[model samples]
Target: MKYTPVQYKVNATILIKSEKSGMLSELSAFEDLSIVKNNNKEVENEIEILKSRPLFKNVVKKLNLNYQYFAKTKFSKRLVELYDNTPIKIIFKEDSLIVDPFANFIISIHSKNDFTITEEGYDSIKNGVFGQVISTRIGSLIINPNPDYLDSFIENEIFLSIKPVMDIVEDYKSRVSIGLVHQDANVISLSLNTTVKAKAKDILNGLVEEYNIDAANDKNQIYENTASFIKERLSIINTELSDIEQGVEVFKTSHNLTNVTSETELFLERSSENKKGVLETNTQLGLVDFMNEYLKENKESLLPVNLGFSEESIIRIIAQYNETALRRDEVLKSTTLKNPIVIRLNEKLQSLKLSLKQSLDNQKKTLKIKLKDLQRQDSVMNAKIASLPKKERELRDIVRQQEIKETLYLYLLQKREETAISLAATVSSAKVIEKAYSSKNPIKPKKRIVLLAAFMAAFLIPIMILFFKDLLDVKIKDKKEIQKKLDIPIVAEIPNTNTKGNFIIAKDDRSIVAEAFRIFESNLKFLLSESNNQTKTILVTSSITGEGKSFISANLSIILADPDKKVALLGLDLRSPKILEYLNLESAKGITNYVSDKNLNLEDIIINLDNIPNLDIINSGIIPPNPIDILKSKRLQELFVKLKSQYDYIIIDTPPINLVADPLLLADYVDLCIYVVRLGYSDRELLSVPENLYKNKRFSNISILLNDVNINSKKYYGSPYGYGYSKPKSWWKF
Candidate 1:
């Protein structure tokens, strides 16, 4: 058999996981597996080929495996670790290498506090040490601990106890460590030996008077206390002086002294001269100096010289007075506005204002010229307007026309409002449902359709299945198909059995084959009785050879030959005659020989099977080369007529209609032609030939005998005994 590739659609319901619900949802769609050739071949073979291929089978297996995995592990732990920054690792059994550095780092820093150092104090110095070290060690392998890491280490043993000690050392080094120093050799000599002794004596007198201590009592204690206090005060003064000196050094460093101009050097010279005079005067000198310079010069002596103030007190008073005078002088100087840069700027600003006033006057003259020109244009426009008609009759006409248009527009607007109101109130003229819920029985799969489908499949699947089962089993399975194609009716159906007995009439009536003969007999009686003229010559034929047409004829003749009527079974298949062998009769003289010889009569070749009373058989004595031409001859018609008169019913088994034209030629001479159609053995497409014959009025009587129908096959229909057919164990096995 030849096969053609055909596209077949298959539908399946598959369960897919829902992304939102994380559960299975049913999905259904048709899929085109592939195009396949199906020329009477087994469907199981195609399924097996599809299942064996790696592409489809692997996909199916992977889907099933994934589903099973999901069932076992509902949550993907790997996915959680990926997004949540959780510390986790898949450790190889052999070696414990850290696979993920980022995860490990997160785990290490999870509990560490974010620390900040104070701007002033030991904390700052400690931070500075680490900062400097980190700056130096960057781009190198050394791990200078960051604030968080250091805090973590400090909280643990060994590092925690040493942290405070390290902080103190770092603070000390930062405060006192000076790496280098330079000295300047310049010096100023001062006549300060006698002055220092006088200042010390004066300070001692003030301490004795202030505390009311006797000058003679505990001199050492007073000296010691005075010296200690003075030394402490001097130390504080020295530190302050050192900070001032450092500021001067910073200024000198920022502005190089070597780069100073002559004018800057002169300014520094004047400042130094003023400082020298102040130092030479000894601002803390005695009251004698003050009185000599002030009261003594005026010759005004105090009332009691003994009550006069001490030299230090007088110097302190004079210093306070000088400080007040100096502060007053500074205030006077700022208010007097004698600064050279400010005076110069004021003078230049005054000169600029005078020049700007002169320039503004000149520009005013130019602006007046342009203003006069604009005034002239304004006058021209006024003169032109004055020259036009004062009443403007055309303007009045336009105004009158606009008023009329406005009135007409208002009228139209009112009409539109009326139309809109009418539309709103109008009834809606449309159909509305009166009875909404008219109930109806749901139409689903029809039982009649299912049963008919089962019957048709039962009739056809076996024949198709048998054709694919083996290549050489050529047999007819349906009688109606043969009748329709050959333009005839079914005479009988013969059951297949392994008995090798003489052709016997079914009188005992207990066998299945005998029951089938009865059915044929009943159909024949109905067919003949309904006709205007009884059909005596019935020709049984098939589409092709080996369709059991001869078997049907012989058995049908036996069933029809009752004690009341005569029946003759004629073997007219001249190409191959198996009737003589079937009946155990010798093919000595038969229809073929009688047709060839002009003097031969039907009586010379007729034989009777003893098992069937009133049943006679005419077997083909010899094979003929031109069976069609012999069947078309006038002698065959005369032979059929003679047998029609002698027999109540003559069943003639002819050759296959599709293989030869003998059946068609013989169909014209027979009273009724019975076509034998084998069910499983017949092709569905071949049924069209018989259908077309009937549609074209080839013969009047026609019926189908479905044969070889397998009632127990699921491919056909469910078994009558309800024994469920099991799926082929290796349905998809290749």
Candidate 2:
């Protein structure tokens, strides 16, 4: 996976900590407004814009992501995408290209300017030069080589895949991740993962550029509006100032006034001080009236800010009102005046407008009071100068008017220049804290870690399967299965032996198998000690055929056949006899022959083995047609009665209980019943038959013998029953 493709994460982090910018426009706008701090919502909104579809749409269109190029070197199996650093550049003729049509082709480069275009689906190849425009089914394509990689891509195949722009945009959007760096910091981080590092960097940088462009435009709207207002005010003020100056010249020339008397000069100097106060008061009143009228006329439009208002509150309110109005205008552009955001902003504007008007009215009343006080003082000074010439007073009035208009004109003109400079220089809104930097290593499919994980999986998977196989196994693997499934006591465990013979016990043998049967004999002595009968009959049977009932019976009888003891190994399985085949003996007449012939006695069916002392084997001789009927005969019970009195111990082997009812039919005749279950052979579900037979008293004194036990297995020899114990593997162990 690591060798297949390498992807790098190109990240660009920016702080949305925009202040009332120091840009000429924003600075001019901020003069009347309080500094509004940037908030988390502003950062959140900026993040949304970073992920906006339209913002990314422009990036995709500018980068031409829809028209993709991939370079495949001769030695490489995967096609490496050619992003901004593409080896070969393809320029399509806009007019000749089909609109958003799907096309795929491979260009094999032999030289810097020579190439062959082969359509992926077509067998034909079209030859083209670097500068020539070649017309094809998809478009008129002009193929060229990048100067930096001109020689490097001589034998490379450049593959082209053109898709729809919408598809490319959606793909780009899905790969982009944008979020805040800190919840309260108003810092945003944007990142994208792609195979081509140059393309990823370009995309992030382009998105930031477009986002700032949008913000600059929003902030520029109010400044441009204010600048236009200042220009109009300056034009009117300039013309009025010019006329006032001309009136002063006309008044002086008509009066023929060249010089003034000392007395008149003294009175004029005193009156001028009063005139300055009146002028300032009137100027403020005029401003207030003009702004009030402007607000009434343009209720929904942005108010011209930075006007000289005496009241700081009025200036701040006007700035706020204009911003709300501007916000409304923007919202209305995409939707309607009825939109909730527009409606809310509109309502806020109305409220701010009312507040601004009241502030203007309050400022106007204060100015009027100041103007009245100044005018009254001027009237007293004029009365004192009543004896002076009326022409001189008229000349003084025109000069004062000229000064007032000129001062007002220059102030407006100064504001206009500042607003114009602000208009020209709209500072960026997005401040990049860190430029786009791609990581040095690929973000995914780390080669070393992946190979290590795969290597370990190869070893662990099989071990886990074997472990689970043992964990989930249902076979009666040990005496634990017998003890866990059945409540009955387990009498003995027969150790597995290499000897194939059914009877493995010998008087002189001291092997583990031989000692195992001796222990079995001791367990039976304690179990049958309470029986009043002189001899004990042991019946051995199983749930399934291959569960080693015959092996248990033959070995047990041979072990019990002591020098002073008489033991008879009876084979009651008339249908299929296995004792003669196991002992390698031939018998013409046995249990079946005696049971079939009413005149025959039990001695005729019993065969004595000369190789051993006091050990007699009864083999089922003539194969009976109906074994169940033959076992049900009155002669069968009488035969067991004679064997019980003659033999000290009789071990009877019968058919499997689950396969036939022959063993269950002899349940009443035995002193002790041994249910043989082969380890690793019998199913766990077969234990239910013995448990049920023991619970139902189907046999007297039922005991389980775990046969063919693997004594070398885990913790088997130390167990209570000395049966091979199989434990499920632990979950963590492979």
Candidate 3:
């Protein structure tokens, strides 16, 4: 099919210049246009993109064209165009032009703190930068009928949408390239190409007028907005200042604290006087205490010597008493106690002592009298200090608040003046360096560049999609999936083995695979503690087949029998029997034979392994017709009861619960039910099946076991279960 080529014949160029700016406006808008954001929904020049997309849509509608078809044709390179065709170009001070419509443009505006230009600021300058060119819409096209149109443009109607009679081309915003006039100039040049010269001239004239008017209006709006914001802040500050002043006045009146400083000085003076009185009283009390203590010793004659007495009369009396005492001691050393001279000296010494004691008691009475007076004075002064006024504290607090509010009010008034000055000094961020003019030659149809881009995208898209598709797989890759999806406890994790046989446990080698079975056995004992006192019957099943349930059961039986306990491995999967094949035992006479023939005893169907000590196996005799019915037999319960008395541990391997009713039917006969889930193989959604069964009490003791886990995986690096006890990897080869 052949279609008319869409190309522009007329071309026009317009210049947007920033007047006194650091080129912040031009740079920011340029960045927004150049940068392509998340999913192409967001752009750097948000304001221009928003206005341009809608403006172009309106233009296409008026011209009566299909927007979807037109956009698709240009994007896919279905309609070939020229290489020299450019859209809008934003030039910086260095003549740097931003012409890429698919890049994210960012402009750095440095302030004391870096100033980030917001989306709103970008919106305001869009029209000033792009100018007011009329938009056309595809719906108005004569060839296509639009249901959204209010009324069709009939032959007699206004005929608002007319097909270009002069073969005029509809140029898109992307095709109208922008560039710099010179390399080292801040001159931005916008160019659009069309098919008609008159249309291009009219569009350029409209753009010049629109750019100037829009730029001037945007500058005025910014001034008005800034003034309004400052005025609002000033009003709030004034209201708060008034409220604070009122509060200060109310507090002063309530507390009766007018002169805060003077009252505080007066109270402080009273406190000082009280402190002096207390000091004097304490001194007097200390003297009285010393005198009382001296009297207690009954050494009144030596009072002047011990206490450093200054009174002359007391000193004279003490000297007389000491003289008499010395004379009596000298006579008593030479004569008998009945001698007249010694007796006379003793009587004199007694006389002096009585006189000294009376004088000293009189001195003590005088000191006690003085101490009581001082104590009374101290008490009165302390009471006065304690009662010092609280009005001073309350008044000081009120005055501090008043001072703060007054300071803030003055600051706000100063800020308001500065804001008013700023409002008056408002200027536009945009400056039109040149008026819009049309070019002599047409510019459109960048055919070569468009074709190259299409080719690159065609080569890379499929490869990228395929790479990401693999990363989005939802299959369970580890034990984390089972843990995240289910609420049940994970009892154990068995590592994936490269052993040749199904029963991967080795008794001779202490490898990781052998140790994993031992860990499973220990976890089983904990799970079976309540129900498995003598012979614990553990039923192992899974969400689906091929989850390693039988492998776990066989190894676990071997580990249990290692402790010199009687262990029995029972194969209860009637639909598919693989335990016998793994054990290389005859499955022709086992559980099925015992169930069919009631007369058969437990020993008739049981197979004891000659190589393993105390280990026995009861394989599924044959694939039964009715597996669920066979599981529900009374003989099966009787057989388990007999096995419980005979063996210490019984491990029962059952069919997958999701596939058959056999496991759920035999769940009652077992002490514990172990649900096996394979890592990296099973679906994450299937874990809910085991969780539901555990919740509804279908199995009394139910726990999940993770199988086929990578031992080197991160699961062992964390948590409550360290699981780091596995043997070395070298043992597997040996």
Candidate 4:
């Protein structure tokens, strides 16, 4: 027969038996602090409680297998037979299974001798033969026996020398480790490395059950006794509280203490009011002291302004005095002080000062009278509060006794109720802080650390990949990037237009876009000053197509045109016309046809709109094969000259600069070039193209019009027009 070697390791912890279901360390501190109050009495009570507990001897006696010999023999029969023929013997010591050899035989590996036995043979067998005696079960010996020796022992040639199995009750009582958790500890750390996880937990559970049951029984008995004591005291307390309450009621009625606290509060309030009155009177007296000192210096005649009077009559006199003094100062500045007019002013000042002195005397007498009245009232309130006193003190004492007795009785009643509930709901004291749990990895070959390492390795690779991807992305995302790369003034930053329709600026609609266009129109006059020229020709373009160049040209033209002026939006983006699509106009005939025919007049290809008051449009007419050559013709230049005379402002939506040369060819005709750069969509490096055009004077006035800008972005700093204008309601309503 062959046996395979296996190992099991488990870890578990138990909590100390606590009186309640909370942190044991904190409860122990409270208990220790309470001991100073009734040390001897509490100690005697605890001892009596321990002595009266149900004896665990009966439970231990029932757990003993030796009392049932028949069951014990049956349980150990197979184990005894496994070593029957060998010189080795098996014995049950307390609760442990022990094995030993009777003869002085040599320890051997595979029948090859390793060491011989001596007088102290059991220790030799324990240390030299089998390593540590962790655990054992039936038919599984700590040391494997020789088959020949086992057969001989079974045949009666070698006798079985087995010791008597000790009592299980004694072993269970002694082996179980149970006590209060440490003052600094809330749990017990148990390392039950044994044959199996279930057996390790079974050991812990048995100890826990014993601890919990004992604690619960003891706690129940204590609560029951305490409840009995409270029941007897409660009757006495109720009678005493009733007697004291009745006595207090009689005393209170005799002394008129129905609203004693209100009386005391009233007294305190009166005192406070009197104190405030005294303080105000004292402040007025201080003011009078200052006034009297001031009057002593100006006894003959007082200047009202020097008194710094707040009274109405004094203020009037001071005003007149100031006016006369001012006239005197003016005369001194320009003429002699003895001049007739100055002398008259001096006489008037003297009369005003005399009147002010009389007013101060009257004010001083009035304040003195007010102060005397306030002081008399304060004295009367203080005497009244002091009048009733000795009877209140006696009543207060009697009432205080009643209150104390009532409060104590109520506290005891509540405590008794709580104790009764606790007695009824008595449960176990000890708990399993940590259940028996083993590492998932095998005991012999560990793998928990390896698995953790593998998990971390898998988690970080993708995070690093995403970080690198974010670091490499460098397209322009906001206005800051445009400012950093381009060297031009961003004249207008048009916030994103979220309406369903493309054209936001119209005559009838007063939306945020319209307000923004108005702001743009205001900024435009400063950006491009038309000092001498009657008409302004603005060319709007970008470094590439789809940069919102056409959108700015269409909206800007509508904003430039007022009810009195004419503004034309020309779809000069001949390669791809967008103004007609934006305004929902037909691409019938425009600059293309007008330039192709030499006889075409100013009104030949122009289209008018009813939706916008003074705005007109010139569609791209037809998709030209070579639009640059057509734009460079003398007829196209002539067409601009005619439009300049007729229109107040002409907004030409030209093709993108890098894509076509039509804008640079007609640069001479344009008064101002607004280069549009769309945030997030246009390449960052392409901003330099417009920047170079502005620097080299490609046009008279050139600036960037950042289109579709995110207004909420931090790069915008803040909104320019405060989001939108608050339009006024029409006064010509029905």
Could you tell which candidate, 3 or 4, scores higher by lDDT?
A: 4
The pairs that clash in candidate 4 are 84-154, 85-149, 85-150, 85-153, 85-154, 86-149, 86-150
Candidate 4 local lDDT, 101-183, one digit each (tens) = 12222222322222122222344332224222323222222343454553333312212222222343344345433332454
Local accuracy of candidate 1 as per-residue lDDT tens digits, 1-734 = 01211112111111111222111111111112111111121223212222222222233222211111001112332211111111121112213322211111111212233212222212321122221221111111112334422443332211111112223323322322111112221111111111123222222222212212221122222223323432443354356545555655565566443343455345436544433332222221222333334333322111111112323333333333332322233233324547664455445444433443343344344434544554455345435444334333223223333433343334334333333333233221111111111113212234566679989999899988877875654444344435444544545455544355544545765555566678788877877776564436677776776657767777778788889889888888888887877666776789889899988888888897677769898887788888777787888888877877787887878777777677666656565556556667776556665666567656555555555444334434322222232334466764
lDDT of 3 by residue, 570-591 (tens): 9998888878887777656889
What's each prediction's TM-score?
0.33, 0.67, 0.37, 0.38
Total backbone collisions for each predicted model: 14, 2, 42, 7
Better of 2 and 3 by lDDT: 2
CA deviation > 4 Å runs, candidate 3:
1-472, 714-734
Candidate 2 residue 429 C-alpha distance from true site, Å: 3.9
Compared with the true structure, all predictions reach lDDT values of 0.44, 0.79, 0.57, 0.60
Indicate the residue-level lDDT of 154 in model 2.
82
Of the candidates numbered 1 and 4, which has the greater TM-score value?
4
TM-score of 1: 0.33
| Clash list (residue pairs), candidate 2 | 24-422, 25-422
User: Residue 544 in model 3: shift from native, Å?
Assistant: 0.9
Worst 10-residue lDDT window, candidate 2: 32-41
What's the true lDDT of residue 589 in model 2? 83
Model 2, TM vs. native: 0.67
Ten residues in a row with the worst lDDT in model 1?
A: 64-73
CA-only RMSD, every prediction: 41.4, 8.2, 39.6, 39.9
